[model samples]
Target: MKTIHKKNTTFLNLAAAALMVAALVLGCKPNVSNGGEVQPPVTDGCTITMSAGANGSITASPVIPAGGKVAKGAEITFTATANPGYRVDTWMVTPTKALTADGQQGDAIAKVKVTANTTVNVTFKPIVYTPVAYADLHNHLTTAQPETNGIYYIEITGLTAPDVTGNSIRDSASPLGQILNSNRQKKVALKFGAIAGVTDMSSCFNGCTSLVQVSDIPNSVTDMYSCFKGCTKLEHVPNIPNSVTDMHSCFYGCTKLEHVPNIPDGVTDMYSCFEDCTSLTSVTLKCEYLDGKFHYAFYDCSRLSTGSIKVPADSLDDYKDNADKMKAEAEWFAKDE
Candidate 1:
């Protein structure tokens, strides 16, 4: 019995040796311990690191814990969201390997494979904005007029947000032709984004009789000729910039406007500026009196009595004399406090 067991053990040992020789000849290599025992590669606790660059934030799906460790070959999905006025610029994958939807379309979401220790980085950058020209807006709206937030608005296709630069409307050749004058019957409430370099605003909103509210006048605008003429429903007047020189017929038919801000000193033309403003009661002038320019400036403002026009204290007598000559008896010039 003992001799038979010995033979069986020797046969098993010989068979193992033969198998090892065959494996070596076939170029098959397996990890072996110093004790001559075969072992498999360890795959536990593999990790994927992720980070978000400036102007954005990142999140992982299936909820990687604080340690961020996972089993090898586990799939993780990442979603990057940009801050306001910004967009994802690029996605960086360290030790690049097989990935799914990896930003080829600038998509914010991507799937990552945890092969070895892997790193996924997402970078965000401020979106470069292109200007919207008058012609560009005109072309888009000619076929269809779109409205947003109660405003007849148009945005450039690629821009992430709206930014009105001065160069946008600098090429406008027509100022007195009522650039944005729309049908008087439709109610319009204008809310302007920042406008930097406009100098001529003549008749820009002219004939927009239904215009009720307007905000943000460009500080660089100098000519406001008939800018809001015939806007009978307009009640609030945006502060006029000091760069203006011509306000001829600026608010000629704004019947609902009751108060006027200090008229800038650079104005040289006020002809019919506030004509037919029947509801107007107060006006403050900062500009020096110009002969004949004040004529008909407040022609039909019945509520604007002679004492209601406030003039600079230093120039009160001269403005009064000019007002008398200009036949603005009902809008008599008074010293401003």
Candidate 2:
């Protein structure tokens, strides 16, 4: 009986030794209770770290705790937000955690499954606007409203000139017209960028009652028919392109226009070009009227009396010969060279 009890004790000792070896292999230790019974090993929670790159901020849903520790199988959500002129670029996860809800680069939301400690990072990039190619660049702002100060600020680049098919900026559907018709007393400031390859600008600013200034017209333009007509408050104008051949009713009803550039010699049509320009003081005629008449070109110019108009000395007789056709007093422009 004593030999049998000794054998039982030896078997219990071998079992305890095997349990210790197995615990070492599994990266855990057996815990002994007060009753000397072995208990399972305990595990600590994992950690998650998040960071945001420049020009943006990152946040997590359900809020990481104060210690940034989470359960081994918790699902964490991350969202990235970009500042103005910026956008989310990419996301990176360290140690290759399981992503249950993955998103491509530039997407703002993602979900990650944390099986181990991991670090999440997000990067941002700036937004760049590419220049549009030259073509019709009009009427895009037709429905845009002005700021509180009653001014429309606009910027456009690569604008090719429009043909005579009523595609000009002064057409009925034009934004410039909308801006003025919304409040005819307000002013508009416009800026142009890189204008090229343009040949026509007919009725470009017609009926813009509050326009007070304009940028230089490109020299490639050849037409100015009714271009600045009905700009009642415009006080100054850029030089007319030397390539222009038409000025039909170009400055009609310009109540505040104060000066006129020398008419280009290429002009072939000047009919009523300055009619009803109530504030025009003087003008010089360089166009010789070779084939076209200037009938009523200066009609109803209340501020332009006799001698207010000037003609080149070389063209005075030619102008005088056509004075009846021009509807101007022949003596009004014959003295000045």
Candidate 3:
């Protein structure tokens, strides 16, 4: 009985040892080989790059592969950078209707199948031209008649001296005076004395047939001759200046001139001053030099039938002597009456 018990114990120990060896062998076995080969990580394809220039330039790289398959509902991106002074104008992508970086128009992208590799580029630049300026009346006002036929009352305020040579305020042959002679020109309002050294009204107002009225006369004027001659429509005249030394035919042939203002104290000569003013009724000669020899001065003023003329009381004798000649010249209006 003792021997049998010992043998059973031995068998139990052997079974336990076999179970331990089996467990160790299974635990020590390798699951993989030791060749040291590395596996590559999966990546979705897209790239970006840049170029530069003197003014500016743009560059892009490794475009979307043509028809290259991408998983459905997958997102893809492309990006670029620009140099100094240049601004990105636009961007675009093509083929498969997959996804886009920024909202841009062109081909849409969904699931991409890149049959051929593609590339794209964007461009940039700066600004260019500008403008200039000019003088105001460089070609506006002139002596020539208005191109369109219409009466224009021109006030030459700032223009006292003509820009061209031989054209001064006192000269009749001036460019401004020539403009006044244009028969097509209806009326003009001349404002003098804006410039210096002008002192006469000779041919300035001569041959201006359309002149109806003249307002301010430059006090600087010293001579007054044919200034008011051909101004047949002039009904009223402002007072002559005291600086005037000559009054030769000043108001001659101004047939419509009905009224005359008082002459300034400095006037000396009155040669044919009121010769053809047939509408003048009363004469006021306040001068001391009204001699009977000053004949034909008020010659053809035929409208003086009943109106009294006031000459220097001392010069009444001189006027009474020349009354016959005055009556002879005034016979035209008398016959009309």
Candidate 4:
């Protein structure tokens, strides 16, 4: 037939060229050129960081966005760093317009606004603490006897004696006989081992007009009437501690004693002693018993006629007949010496 029909058309054109080379070796092989340019795939948002256990650490960025939608006011900002010695005293932001910066030198920065998912709080404080000192004089008859007003300064360093029955200090029952009739203490210092077991210091610094000072006097004190009655700034009268006997009214109104000490011979009774001192200038007596007859004992001593009056020349006729008013005050202080 025509060569078998042209061999079936050359076997159908070699099966159509072997199906187009097997579809070009399985779809066009090598076309590789990966020189970059492909990106696009990374989405992560919401982030915040801050920490401090001993002090230091803070950060905030990406607090939610990238399509996660949290933007109701978006404005977050935060930064803080300070470790070593730790110092960043203040920086705050906690719900309410948030905005702060102060401390850590400069740049502690802070700003807030993501309205919904919010939480901010920060605080720090420390500076100094240490100091103390005390001296509280007899602590107001022991622990401020129920504190009434206030006015205290204590420095009575070791009182010599006299605590009679003030309970040694406890609401004072006799605290030195009620501080010898206190007027709210203006100044007092009976310091240096305050004579103890006082016998009878009559009136004991009577109306102490803020006694200036009356140091050590305790030879086992015996008796001395009205001892310094209305002491209006007594000038001097310290030595008399020979275990005295009796010298009544001893310096009644020491208007400002000038001098009067040598009256030691176991005094019997010079009653009304120096009644109204009025600034007596002199007096020396070795008492052998004036027999208490100087009635008003130099009544208004008016400066004792201006000084000098020693007794004991053998009791000068029993002190001029039982001291006729102290022999007219020792002949008016021997006619003014």
Number of the top lDDT candidate: 2
Arrange candidates, best TM-score first. Answer: 2, 1, 3, 4
Query: Per-residue lDDT tens digits of candidate 2, residues 1-337?
Result: 9999999999999999999999887555466687976665537677899999999999887688988888888888898866645557888887664667764576667798888878999998864432322232233334455443344444455454442213344344134344444556566544455556766667777787767555457788787877778888776576787899988888888987867777887888899898888878788777776535588787777776777877767778877777667666676675455
Candidate with the larger TM-score of 2 and 4: 2
Off by over 4 Å in 1: 1-180
What's the lDDT for candidate 3? 0.50
Tens-place lDDT per residue, model 4, 279-326, is 576777776644544466667776655226666667655554554565
Model 4 segments beyond 4 Å from truth?
1-158, 161-207, 210-219, 222-242, 245-249, 254-265, 268-272, 277-296, 301-337
Which sections of candidate 3 miss by over 4 Å?
1-151, 159-175, 193-195, 290-293, 324-337
Best by TM-score: 2
Query: Lowest-lDDT window of 10 residues in candidate 3?
Result: 127-136
Please give the CA lDDT of all the candidate structures.
0.67, 0.69, 0.50, 0.52
**Model 1 C-alpha lDDT per residue in residues 24-100, reported as the tens digit of each score:** 87555466777976666654667788899988888887778777788777788887766654556678876678365
**Per the 3 Å backbone cut-off, how many clashing residue pairs does candidate 3 have?**
14
Q: How accurate is candidate 4 locally (lDDT)?
A: 0.52
Better of 1 and 3 by lDDT: 1
Model 2, which residues run further than 4 Å from truth?
A: 1-158, 163-183, 189-191
Question: How many residue pairs clash in model 1?
Answer: 2
Candidate 4, residue 105: lDDT? 26
Q: Is candidate 2 or candidate 4 better by lDDT?
A: 2
> Model 4 TM-score?
0.23
C-alpha TM-score for every candidate: 0.48, 0.50, 0.46, 0.23
